[model samples]
Target: MCESPVRHAHSLLFVPATRPERFVKALASGADCIIVDLEDAVAEGSKDSAREQLAQHLPQLTPGQLTRTVVRINAVGTRWHEADLALLRNWTMHGATVMLPKCEDAATLRGVAQKLGDGARIVALIESLAGLDAADALAREPHVVRLAFGHLDFQLDVGIHATADEPELAFARSALVAASRRARLPAPVDGVTTDTGSAERLAVDARRARAFGFGGKLCIHPNQVAGVNEAFGHTEAERAWARRVLEEAARHGGEAFSLDGRMIDLPVIRAAEAILGG
Candidate 1:
């Protein structure tokens, strides 16, 4: 498996690549990563034109840019896959991460990785029921650097009731989290909240995702970026607690200790270090 640099608190903003007018605006939207989306956002008739637009604009991106640019290509069984792959083969961008949607199995991922040839990274989109079921195997693929949940499509596919709490989708989220940890990848990212202007709702959803072990989230609009970043980022209180936990554990010579009258175990210390980015 190809190793990637440890991801920071990233806010991945999704934009329709078919709309050339929106691309520049999305690039300037204060996101850590800008996803040039060719799937879900683009209409059937616009896929060809979107591919053309992406091909033309992909070359203009320079290295050391503020945003990490990626292309979200269509699924393997779709008509756009061949053209998308062909376009990506020649496009020059800084560390292009291919967002493979609806990734069902390891074979499909291996096929894409073979084409990328170590130059690009793969972020597997585990959307459907089958994809969730095969997440562990898919994560084992050498090219898959990140895993993102596709909540909207997943809800429809599994006939699950969607809510802010999303009790029915909990199993899928847990599966992805476990798979990511098993593969030693960064924590999986949560799906998007389509309500663009509702920062309050976005904050709530972001917190829920964080509690579920997601390291980051996908955003449909720029307005939600700050809230998502804040939700995922460590607060001063968390960092302080983590530091204190480590100090106490060290004094005990790696034995279990208690802080603030609460018992601190190995898992607790590890979680604290994770939050502090140690």
Candidate 2:
């Protein structure tokens, strides 16, 4: 698989494709990836105009900004899906990223791969029971770079009335993470925190995602970027510990050892490497 810029993104911010003026600003919002949303963000009647807006303004972005940007097309079975793919033809050839919403099967992703060809990178959004059940298959798709949780729609689809903390979705979150690991993909991205105005809520959500082994959180607002970034990032103390662990491992010739009364084995060494690697 080709390297994906969003593979380790900590914050994926959404900007409505209809609002082209905000594109540059969203890219500058310190988000690791900016998702240009053409799915839920655009009304049914405005889909075509939204594509037109993107066609006109997307080219204005610098190559670097475009590299960090992802275009979220309508779901596979939606009326606008084919048109969205058509609009993305040139962009995909130039190494653009695409996020497929409500991805429930490998065949759908295969179809997209055929359309986007080799240059495009795909993020599969799991939002329904069908999607959750097929998470393993979806993750194993060669073109899929990562899996993302769409918790809001997922809850509705499964008739789950989850609370703010959303403990009910734990199983689904773990399933995605496991599937990604099995497929050797980066840790999956977590769903968005709908309460955009609450910094505390965003922080809690981002941190909770990190605890669940998610690499990133989706954000509807630019304000949520810093919180997500901080949550996914390692602290100075964590870096120091990771460095010490590696030094000790080297001294011990990569064998198991004890550090601060805790066993520093292969698993611990790997964890330390991941922390320092990021």
Q: How much does candidate 1 score in TM-score? A: 0.89
User: What is candidate 1's lDDT per residue for 192-219, written digit by digit as tens?
Assistant: 9888978888998899898889988999
Which number leads on lDDT?
2
Local lDDT at 65 for model 2: 78
Q: Kindly give the stretch of ten consecutive residues in candidate 1 with the minimal lDDT sum.
A: 1-10
Global fold similarity of model 2 (TM-score): 0.97
Off by over 4 Å in 1: 1-9, 91-94, 247-255
Candidate 2 segments exceeding 4 Å error: none
